[model samples]
Target: MSSPCFPPLEPPALSPETPVPQGPVAPPLPLPSDLSSLAFPLPASSPQAPIPPPPPLPPPPPVGGLAPPHVFGLEKSQLLKEALEKAGPVPGSRDDVKRLLTLQKDRFRSDLWWILFCADLPSLLQEGPQCGLVALWMAGTLLAPPSGIPLERLVQMAMDRGYTAQGEMFSVADMGKLAQEALGCQAELLCGGLGGPNRERVLRHLVSGHPLLIPYDEDFNHEPCKKKGYKAHWAVSTGVLLGTQAVPSLGYSEDPELPGLFHPVPGTPRRPPPPPEEGSPGAVYLLCKQGKSWHYQLWDYDQVQDSNLQLTEFSPERAADGRAYVVPEGGVRAGLCGQALLLSPKDSGR
Candidate 1:
């Protein structure tokens, strides 16, 4: 085989800057063939000039009168202004003002609801001066009392409104329900407006069976109950009972004579024992009526130790001769036996 054919190579010394020699040659536009024959040399570059020093930064603007405009958004500036305004002082701080306003709003709402409730009462029941008086008393008790409104006046108003005594007995249960409702209103009005503990105290006094109003007597012996010739005022009993429940220590007694009984002996100060050891005789006896027989029960702390410490049973045989029967020899004291006897008047005759 013949050697592979190749294109003719141009000499390296021939370049575009070097013109080809031709006698009296006329100039012509470069043709594709002529361009392909020419080779262009790369231009020589000067050494890179030294980088110039950076220009100095301008000084910060002068300290402010008003802040620079639009640096922060318009909304942000407005927010800051609002914050400053809120932080500014009045008679009270913003929080205090807010609390007072909340209290007022609550009071107004409660008053509106109460008025609406009372308005729904039958016309005959709602009519007369007593109704207006009740409304005023309700306002004073539930909201903050208006200036110069006395508790006695409110009591009198309640009396006038047929809310007081029915026959010889005072309707204490009804009054208690009313008191509870009034306390609820007060709680709504005062919550968050007063200090937490004080608010709680107010709530406790109002809702619980403690007497908010105490009767005063010029002569202690000749009080209203005595003068009225009533057995014991229901209000006094209710208030005492309620107060006892609230203060468990004040209300209950562990005395053997009154064990496991609630609200025993009104106004009697309670004396609780020191905590006892596990197996010690921390028993209390309670006078309880079981069917026709009266029994003295013994309790150990919370549990019943003896259901029948002394059983009081009536026997016509003992009563037939009109002589006291000799008490049987027993585990407990003779005085306890006598106590059992004393408990049942019918048994004593027997």
Candidate 2:
């Protein structure tokens, strides 16, 4: 494959000048099918399988600046280039870029699409337990807030009223309420309350262009953290990639260069890297805004779905230490998560 779409696992810090070597790429590691968290159970496959760690995806360009002139090996269309120009001359400081991307999102090749606005969003915000709030903000960036209520204002109100600055915004109920009241949108929880891993429903939503705000286990995703001190994490499910039955185990393609039925990109050398494993060419992946600084994540389908299952009826560890007469807002003791929240503008009438 022309330069692997992902860098080598745990590779040394790389500069663009480093020459990438050509070798047999390892397949994605088999995550445990067990619905468990950070202190995870082992994978179901035999220990002798040749599964390797997943390839890491690069972070998207700054939203406030110009998008990459070239994506993969294909040159962006003139229309897309013109649109990028409309985002302004600044390379990494365009506030209007989000509005432009929301309008032109469909123009992106599905494989390269996901509403990712990370650490740079709201310069005042920092990555922390506030991931739930950040996920909401990331999703909101793709949607237009109610007239007269700028998205920035809603973010400020959340920081003032929500505990994003103090701690995590892990409460499902409170976050849904925040969406309705702060952003004038409605939030729906798709998988919860003793639900099983349901990729079909999530697939439908992603295909319909409705991204889900999902809860995840930090340890399961291998995110850097203080062991399990704060395990619950939230992210936005921007899009999906699924494999098809055809090809030399090259995997499926959302973008077929023909006038026929949908299929994963064929295993041709011309296509981007195929499924990490030739054995499981039909594997699926979920693209999420894991909110790492300058990084988006490509998670194995079953692993992420199972990750959600592990987060049922979760409660904050510090829900009780508050001053008398002033119960802390984060004192919420219980909440739910399967896929977590499905947010839409109230105007959509979903």
Candidate 3:
């Protein structure tokens, strides 16, 4: 037994043919160019995970009624309403009457001429005839002579002659005769008769009275209106009377029957007075009849009390001078004077 055990112990001398145990060797990996390229594996995520959208912006604030961010104080609409109310009723509305009344009560008045100029004359005429008449009368008085004669004596004469006198009642022939006698000219010549000595005599008398009527010598070489200028001798009819003078005159015309004498009153109205005060504000009311048509007007003075007047109104027509004077319809009352004394533009040199 001893011999067999010894041989088993030395049986296999250690040799390369013995099996050897080995540790695991990792699988060959691909190398990257940079150190940051190293990657670690991550766990897989769920397929059902959802993404969210961005939040929405707020809306702009309301206007007018609601106070906006920019407007830190009162609402604009309310302020506007308050302002309009303070301004009172709108123009052309019923409330406008109240505004006018208030203005009148406050004494907001204007000049007479300005008022008439701005007024609607047609409306006024339709509303008040007497007012229209008064305005017309005032205009005439202002522009014309003192209603034919001086106030102090005219009333007495009118009363004595009877208020009912009509159509040359005051002896037109006698008046003509008086003029000739006063002028020291024969009646025939003054009345415009044959030529020669009678005409010369009449001419001389007229020159003496009105120096403006004297004929000027061409050799004088002076202006017709110069201080020493010669004038043509002539007679002028002033409605109720005849005037012979050398002073400049207006409203003159020529008629074959009377060469140098003015036969017809240019702008005169044949009527009795209510004379306007001399040097006072007044007007003339002309009631002229062309056939059956009646024309009325108002006039004003450009200077001090004088016979130079301008038309301011007419029925169914307007004045050429852009002036108008009309009374509110039914607004004119009695006892109010209309006529005014007007100065001649020549006299005023305006």
Best by lDDT: 2
| Winner of 2 and 3 under lDDT | 2
CA RMSD per model (angstroms) = 42.4, 26.0, 50.0
Native RMSD of candidate 2 (Å): 26.0
Best by TM-score: 2
Q: Which stretches of model 2 miss by more than 4 angstroms?
A: 1-125, 145-156, 159-167, 193-198, 220-229, 246-282, 312-333, 347-349
lDDT of each: 0.25, 0.47, 0.23
TM-score of each: 0.17, 0.47, 0.16
lDDT of 1 at 158: 44
* Ranking of predictions according to lDDT: 2, 1, 3
| Whole-model lDDT, model 1 | 0.25
Across 1-350, the per-residue lDDT of candidate 2 in tens digits comes to 01112111121121279998899989998866763543744464957345767899899766645333221111335654464456444323223333333454443334332222122222112233456666676667545442334434545665666424544665665566666665656566554421233345456555445667776677654442222223667777656554443433343333222221233333334332233232342255555665442234555566665566555433345444441211234232245344366665556655
- lDDT score of residue 285 within candidate 1: 17
Total residue pair clashes for candidate 2: 7
Runs of candidate 3 exceeding 4 Å displacement:
1-152, 155-164, 167-170, 176-196, 211-350
Candidate 1 per-residue lDDT over residues 142-207, each given as its tens digit: 233234244344455444444443111122222332333332221111111112232233223322
Question: Which of candidates 2 and 3 reaches a greater TM-score?
Answer: 2
Which pairs clash in model 2? 64-94, 65-91, 252-264, 252-265, 253-263, 253-264, 253-265
Cα deviation in Å at residue 330, candidate 3?
Answer: 46
Candidate 3 on 1-350: residue-level lDDT in tens? Answer: 11111110111121279888788989998767774554643223534334345577676544422121111112435664454446432222112222332443332222211111111111011111122122222222323344422222322332343321211111112222222222222222121111222223322222222211111111222111211211111111101112222212433333333233233233543222222232323221111111001111121221201121111122233224354332323211110111111111122221
